[model samples]
Target chain A: MTTANAIRLRYALRRERFSLDVEAEIPDRGVTAVFGASGAGKTSLLRCIAGLERAEDAYLELDGTRLDDSASGLRLPAHRRAVAFVFQEPRLFNHLSVEANIRYGRQRRSDRSPAATFDELVEILGIEALLTRAPSGLSGGEAQRVAIARALMSAPRLVLMDEPLSALDAARRQEVLPFLERLHARLPVPLVYVSHQQDEVLRLADTLIALDSGRVFASGPLEALLARADVPGLSGAAAAAVLHGVAGSMDDEFGMTPVESRAGQLWVAGRHPNGTTLRLLVPARDVSVSLAPLSASSIQNSLAADIADVLPCSDDSAVLLKLDASGVVLFAHVTRRAVAQLDLRPGQTVFANVKSAAVRPVFAESPPGPA
Target chain B: MTDLGPLLLSLRLAATTMLILLVIATPLAWWLAETRSRLKPAVQAIVALPIVLPPTVLGFYFLVFLNPNAFAGRLWFEATGSTLTFSFAGLVVASLFYSLPFAVQPLQSAFETIGRKEYEAARTLGASPLDAFMSVVAPLCRHGFLGAAVLSFAHTLGEFGVVLMVGGNIPGETRTVSIAIYDHVESLDYAAAHQLSAILLVAAFAILLGVFALNRRRAAAAS
Candidate 1:
């Protein structure tokens, strides 16, 4: 499969004390999650792209269109630019009713694009009953749904979500994230999701741009960048990678998506798009090793990979193995118990059995690694 | 027997004065609440001046200014063929000046108390400044406007020195409720004074009750 058009943003933007220094490129076709700590300037970088904040020496081009280039002093105003931003707080207009607030951004779009129907959005967000209520009356989840609906209505070329779920509690976040997944899979516009949570980015993003102290720490395919043991906070135990696959056949009776990946046939239980790519993450600790592929197992996925490295840390209790499949590096933490049982050794061909449900997509990079 | 002439004249003067003040104060208070002009503090202090000055001081200035011999008085006399003092119009002017601050400060403070972040939210969403002011600021400042109106009306109803100096208590031409009560008291007709005092007390209480009742309605609506 070919990669879609993307944005290339390079240059430095400095202010008196806090400066946003960056060099990065994100695909124009899918979600590019900016993951960082609270003060790592993730939101500032988004704001610069959205034209909400001006930055000197900031060069940003989206799919070949020059949106901001400060070397020659070129920039677009927030409203004039093709980006719509959803702040951490819902920020719905209090004087307006829910319906009116959703329509506020809809009225601002000058170009004709495929807009999410008002009814569709309200239905998807489950906010049909809240149309006439004032913003003051909405609960946090409901208000965020309205915010998301409002932002989507603008038909932006690139939508910026600045910690949209950060203000929500866990249960509420769980409720909204699935809707976000479905929305991203459905919408045509690219998204730049900014978050501090690695789980969220792992579950949602196609491209991950990890920032540290206002600099790009790593930028690439979410799974590939994250799978490497060298990724700051993601090393050893926390290392995880996103995997993309297509639904091969329906097993509705068993409730599984038969995914066709280079890792071999993997079956994950969910309602997945038939042929389109679905992203899922496989954490480092979740995989188990066996010299021979077990056919009688209950686990769904058994992938064939070559052992890339075997780092034997102090404890014979466990070992870190880097398995390479083409250009992808997947990590597995085998306990000393399993290593001895299977007689696992370096350069040995092995079958790594990972539960289909245990796999999830790379959504966000680990927080601004090491401050 | 009740004197219908003075009561009717007083009611009419009070009604017109309050109405004009409401219209004038609404916009002035709105501006005072939002604008950060260099002149705002001075304007606020001046609006509040009427509350502290003796009514006679305020009235005497108006009285002199509106005298036919004075420049303003001569202009009105030549232009409208009306002398300034001892007229219903002159009492209206005096009452308005006296109650101006009562109508402004509460509203200004109310407007100021509303957070600026709310307005900024609307602006980034593509609302013009005027639209944000009308849609965001005005609705939030509703309570202050009501308070100012109630206070100004009640304060104007109790005016004495300004009306006495500028209105001259002409029975049907310039007299007000306060002036009528004063007239009865001065005449030493204890019975009449008591009757007028009872009526004024009831009126003030009723007016305050209505303000409070309306405030409750506004609160419910806001919620």
Candidate 2:
């Protein structure tokens, strides 16, 4: 992307034990997930972008606006940056009611664009009933939703979320993830989401920036990066391919749904309405390779594929194989002994069996309507 | 019958001292709570000196510093044709010093308890530093402000040595309740002393009761 349509960041911070040095240009659209382990400078990077933590040698430009230039001694304060942040905790003002907390930023916003109306955000976050309640009375999920609404109401040019769902329990995370997905699809302002949870990234992010030891190990489109078997954390045990497809029809007798994608047709164990777009997450471990098509197998989904590349896993017992299934990429984890026995190589034809039960449908596109 | 002038003068002095201390202690307490500077301990020590140092010592310093010939006293004398020593204004100044810790300690602790996370959150939400403090910090710490005001007022009302050294015994201008009780006792009038003393004791108890009740309510709400 051109400089006018991207966020360029160059920061170098040195502390007693840990140091951060990163330089990247991220597209100013869609959800860009900053994925890394704990203490990988994820929160530090977000803080620097929000102007909360000033790096001595830093230059940050968002959509061509010079937010910070250490060389010229120009730095905008956090309030003036028009960059809103949602912390892991709700951090709502205890003195104000939920409605007041959400309106606090909207009233003080310097940009009077009226991008998202108060009623619309309240409805979108499902916080209309919580407007009059105090933040202290809300549950973890409810408070977080209010916090998200507060950030959006600020009319920020960019929004930064630092593990917005990390503090919650599993059920609360599930409760808030749908609202986040809705925001991902509907928000005009780009989001830089910091998370170590792979499932959240796979569900919400369009682009991914993986950080290792405070440096950018890889940065690209999410599909392309996750498809690479060579990247350490992106592959191996957490390896999964997110396939975009449209729902074809539901088999009422078998209780399954057929999804059509560029790769091929795959039957998932669910019922989805026809014509709705869906993303299916197929884990590599659930896929097994056979030399020829299995005539009488329990696995319902099978596709003919050419072996693209075989990569060694961290543990030597198994190997991760990259498969190109008609222009769509998929991964399969097969044992080293099986690879040796079958003598699998690139350019060889194989039938990949996928367990329909293991295929999870995530982030379905809502039917077009008032929302 | 005991004269009521000293009691009224004491109330006026305490009210004036509480108001002025709140204005002066707020920013100082906020700085003390938020700053990581090396000078923080030193500033805190100076603010707390009144609680540890004898009131006579502070009064002696005030007397020496605010006499007619001294710099501050000369400026006051030139401007208002009166010295800062042995006046109602002098008593007010002495009471402020006597009650400085009462005003600052509660406020500083309150600010520390609220922490910087909420303040930073407000800033990112497009509030300036001052705006964040007023909208977020002040309202959250309203009880702390009230506690400070009450403590300062009570502490100033009971002050004896500082007023005796700096303000002397000017009945309506500077003689407070404490001095009036002392005067009554020194003149062998036990009845007058007992009446004023009982009034001060009940007033102090009521003010403290109000503060403790407020604190209990806050704690209950928090829990």
- DockQ (C-alpha based) per candidate is 0.25, 0.90
What is the CAPRI rating of model 1's predicted complex?
acceptable
lDDT of 2 by residue, A162-225 (tens): 9999999999999999899877767778899999998899898888988888788888888988
Candidate 1 residue A205 C-alpha distance from true site, Å: 2.5
Error of 2 at B115 (Å): 0.5
lDDT of 1 by residue, A149-219 (tens): 88887667778899999999999999889778777666777788998887888788878888777888888
* Overall lDDT per candidate, in order of appearance: 0.75, 0.89
lDDT of 1 at A53: 66
- Highest-lDDT candidate: 2
**Residue runs of model 2 more than 4 Å from their true location after superposition:** A252-255, A365-371
